[model samples]
Target: MKWSEFKIHTTNEAIEPVSNILHEAGASGVVIEDRNDLDKDWSTMYGTIYELDPENYPEEGVYIKAYLPVNSFLGETVEEIKQAINNLETFDIDIGHNKVTISEINEEEWATAWKKYYKPVKISDKITITPTWEDYQPVSSDEIIIELDPGMAFGTGTHPTTVLSLQALERYIQTGDSVMDVGSGSGVLSIGAILLGAADVQAFDLDEVAVKSTTINVKLNKVQDRVTTRQNDLLKDIDVQADVIVSNILAEIIVKTTQEAYQLIKPGGYFITSGIINAKKELVKQDLEKQGFNIVETNQMEDWISIIAQKPE
Candidate 1:
């Protein structure tokens, strides 16, 4: 089989939303090449190894690459992806150059080439994300290991937004508390919640692939019985209330669902949200506050932001 690789050049602020747009356009996975990553001090024993090729990286901004099978509708899919990316500017997101390129490759290369980019990453104080193909050992007695194989899915549980969300989960999850995971990609948060002693988790995603990926990942961590997966738009018509509600999606979606999230969480429960770029933090913060949630914590890593808010009892 043949596959088309679409490489999009855009600003750092546009990477997350553009990648999401590509995913929604039927791309299984995406590769991000941020020029800033080349400047990071990565030799400080961060417990994560990244093997990046300088040739493929952008000279400015970032490059996001995704693969789609060579089919009759391939051209239409690519055009739609471009249009969706252009729509980001309406949200005041800087898209930079927004240059797009395409190339064809064999399916075999697509299957194995991406593995080299993933490694054992210690994302937070107690949680470490390891790919299924890697041989990893627990370096600490209390360390929590999340084993995941994104397969054709987009998340590997190591993105800054994901890391911040997991770290927040670590700090707030209580033993036997119920968790509601909105946009639970790869089921990483649900698995993390269960590991952190949450009694049960209801995970939802609008994407069918994400729902399936979450189900498989929950079972991979041996928490299928504790975590339930389903396809649902964020917090619409959901009657079940949870001890804690978490979402790691775009700031636009997060803000739109803030009120519903507030209604779905138990009194005094917490709402943790990420996938917010640095510039949009204040907007989301104000939205959550307007919905009667008291902002408790704000976390930032790189260009991303995460907020933890509590519903007043």
Candidate 2:
């Protein structure tokens, strides 16, 4: 089968939303090529090698690439993706050049070529995300391994936004705590929550595709019995209190759920929010505070920020 490589050249700030657009447009796997990664001081603590080629990355902005099968509706799908990306600007997200290009490739090539971009990496002290195809052994007795298939989800669970969320979960999640994962794309966070000692998790996503992806990934990690995947708008008309509520989505959407999150969290519970750019960090902080949450911690990885707040007991 033939596939079209749909590539978008945009700013670092737009990577989350733009990659989301591509996923919503039915692109199963997305590849991000950020020039800044070339200079990043990746940790070799676990012997996770990153063999990136300079030629594959952009000089300035990042490149978000995905593969879509060649079909009659391909043109319309691409246009919808472009429109959705442009719509992100209304949320104050910078779309940068937003230049798009397309190329044709064989299925055999894409099936394995993209795998090189992903490998076992320790995002946090306790959590290490490895693609399903890789054979990785725990470097420590307490090391947590999360197996993910990027082709089956929106993200590979290695993005900075996700890493921050998982790290926050690692820090705040108590043993046998109940966790509610909003915007649970790829079910990575939900799975991570369970691995981090959460008794059970209620994973919700507005996108049916995301829900399906979450369900698949949850089972892949052998945590299906502990994670429940649901298709629902962000915390709307849902009233299940949890020990922790974690969401890694756009700051705009994160703010919208602040009230619901506050009400749904148990007293002294925690709320963790990520997928926020540096500029919008303060916006989320203020909103959470307005909803009566006490700011506990704020962390940043690269250009993304994660804010953790606790409800007064």
Question: Largest TM-score belongs to which candidate?
Answer: 2
Among these predicted structures, which one has the highest lDDT? 2
Could you give the C-alpha RMSD of every candidate to the true structure, in order shown? 1.7, 1.3
lDDT of each: 0.88, 0.91
Candidate 2's C-alpha lDDT?
A: 0.91
- In candidate 1, stretches whose alpha carbon ends up further than 4 angstroms from where it belongs are 43-45
lDDT of 1 at 236: 87
What are the clashing pairs of model 2?
none
Cα lDDT tens digits for candidate 1, 115-203 = 77778988888999998888899998999999998774556787778989999999999999999999887899999999999999999
- The digit string of per-residue lDDT tens for model 2 on 1-313 reads 8999999999988987787788888886888899988888776443444798999998898999999999999999999998999998898889999999999999997787678889998888888899888999998999999999888587788778998999999999999999999999899999999999999999999988789999988999999999999999999999779999999999999999999999999999999999999989899999999999999999998889999999999
**Stretches of candidate 2 above 4 Å error?**
44-49
Give the TM-score (vs. native) of candidate 2.
0.97
